[model samples]
Target: MSAPLSRPSYAAVLRVPRARSTFAAALVGRLAYGVVSLSLLLATVRATGSYAVAGTVMALFGASTVLLLPLRASLVDRYGPRRALAPMAVLYAALLSVLAAVTWRPGTPAVVLGAVTALTGACAPPLGPTMRMVWGELVHDRRLLQRAYSLDGVAEELLYVSGPVFVGVLIRFASPSAGLLLSAALIAAGTCAFVASPVVGGLRGSSGRRQQGKSPARQRGLLQPVLVAAGAGLTLSAVDLLVTAFAERHGYGGDTVAWMLAALSAGSAVGGLLNGAIDWRTPARVRLPWQAAGLGLTVCAAGLAPGPWTLTAALACAGAFVAPALTTAYLIADETAAPGARTRAGAWINTAVNAGSSCGAVTAGLLLSHASLGVCFAAAGGAALVSAAGAVVGARGTAVAAVEAEPVPEAALEAESGRSGA
Candidate 1:
């Protein structure tokens, strides 16, 4: 039998300057997102006095983000992130101030709050995708790109997991409004620094080509993958909501939710590291199913947890699959996208994630009001299973295509031939 294929080494991918700059930008943006996200969730609950209402507010917020993500991505691609980031940051801060002002009136109509929330969501810059694209452009070697993506994924997990705990502590001692205000300040400062960075400035002058013609129908078609990705995101979000609700029902309290979520983030960080380290010769189709299976199993096991600690463990296990899923989806989008559609593809994925999370939250709230938390967990678990099945199918197709593709470099072909001849 031929010798087993060896994976690409990380050493092959480590270019210094670009990697450092990408990491710095990603860290700054993630920190800003983390602060804002945690503050928003806590403040909404404090202001509304109902988890259901808070979920709704968050749903509206996500809806706005989903709607605006493509537009934002396009702008980033055209004008570059530096030019687009500043105004978005300013608008986001201003909108948060409005949200902080209106939040005190408790009796203020939900409709008004929702509108404001939507505006806040809309103003959120597509920082994650923009940064990812920057990494893709900046990193010349494929192996390095893999490492950069892995790093990006880790940063995301840290942001989400840590941000909430920090905000929760602040809200416990100070006030939720204070947390929100602080979030705004962080966003402003981070975005400003990111914009001012020389790396970003250099990118500004590179290109202004619109990816596609200004046809609405064509744009919609191009966005179909994003829509599918969004569906997946919504399902995952629902699972998260269910997990949180279930934890609370078991007398875990609000703080437990933070810990459980953190577990998931930790798992994701591990997954990202693994994804970066493994130079799989197998096509994505072979890998995607395993990733999805891990995610599904983790969700299902979470329902079997005996207590908060067990639940946290299960969620953390589930989180291990999160980054791989995200990475696979991004890779698929990159491979499948038409010329000039990269930004849109990235934006769509972000939109799907936010949209999915929003839907999940709403669904969890409804289920919590009527059914036992166990039912919600089971439902979420089932959804994850379904996602796994879909991923498997997609992976098979991708693998077949890869197998039929043209051969690689002469060295690679020779290596394969040599192994076979041996």
Candidate 2:
């Protein structure tokens, strides 16, 4: 039984130089993405003078991400992150520059902008998933994986919180194009640095398989925990929308909404740091419940906040659970995925979150347009409760046992990995 795969100590994992680099790369890449996202929204609005059209362009970008992400995951799985990172980063940078240039010209057709945006979207670097996969492969111990995930989650929150603010400030004081251009440069530099890092380049896939004279084709599957995590992601999306609407309704203007959102991200950053600081001896079962409770509390606080400041505090508290939940999900997914299918599983999680976000956004918009803000808050709180319930349920099952029974084929794993690494 491989000694039940005892969890590795936290200190042992932190000592890994590669893990540190991976985390740094993830942080920078995410920050760059945040800047680009805000810049794109502003640029589109500036160019078209139509919020509706700007929204459409952004939606297309999301659609492109949803469609192409899986393919990107496949490439990561097959070729490793090092091999595929550069092209994607370069292409993303190039596309962003093109977007800035075309938007600079007066009378640049919206159709042309939309087409470029979609094509550029395809170039998005699969940094998050690839990093997660690499962490899983390189870290080995389950406890280490949890810590890594916790840190990654925190970085994600920080990026979303700070990146947009930076972009917004730059656009207001400098030029909107500056934000976009900076985003490109950051992505290019970060991606290249990650690829060239000794830890990433020196690592080889399937050391165990090679020693045993087995081929890489021997690994692939459905990873049940990831699927459950994906479901939970849907719930989180719904909650996010509810919170946003609730803030807007309570006399919090657009700026307040941004701050409230940032509060949540900040909380996530805290959670991630906490995860990394904790001892690995703690069982996930115990840790997961506490995380869920935090999430529930966040919702309740957000729903009941009497003023904008109070609501922001509540949102931050709620946000603190974000990394823990993500850590739980990523750990589960890593355990359940077939060796080569890790990236796909991660990408699927991303897809689920995006889908959930889309649904939540639409629902929240409709509700806010027609109903009171309190109702939106209540709805969001309710959705968060659902997520908490799901996490509770997930905690009870073994990572491998929580997933579907069907096994993924080795060929499929290879194919998907290859596509992701590309």
TM-score of 2: 0.80
Q: What TM-score does each of the candidates earn?
A: 0.77, 0.80
Q: Where does candidate 1 clash, by residue pair?
A: 230-352, 234-356, 238-360, 268-319, 285-395
- Highest-scoring model, TM-score: 2
**CA RMSD of all predictions:** 7.7, 8.6
lDDT of 2 by residue, 1-422 (tens): 01123454455555675666666766677678778888888888777787887888898888897778978877776666777777899999999999988776456778988999999888898888877777776666565667667766666766766787798678777667678888998898888878777766754443234222122221222223333344345445665676566655565667777677777777778867787667656666445556655676567567667787887887787777767766776675565567766776777767766765676667666777776666666665555556556655655444444344347877789888885445
- The 10-residue segment of model 1 with minimum total lDDT is 1-10
Error of 1 at 86 (Å): 2.2
| Candidate 2, lDDT over the whole model | 0.69
Number of clashing residue pairs in every model? 5, 19
Candidate 1, residues 219-319: lDDT per residue as tens digits?
33334334435545655687667766676566667767867776777788888889888776776545655676677666767777778888788888887
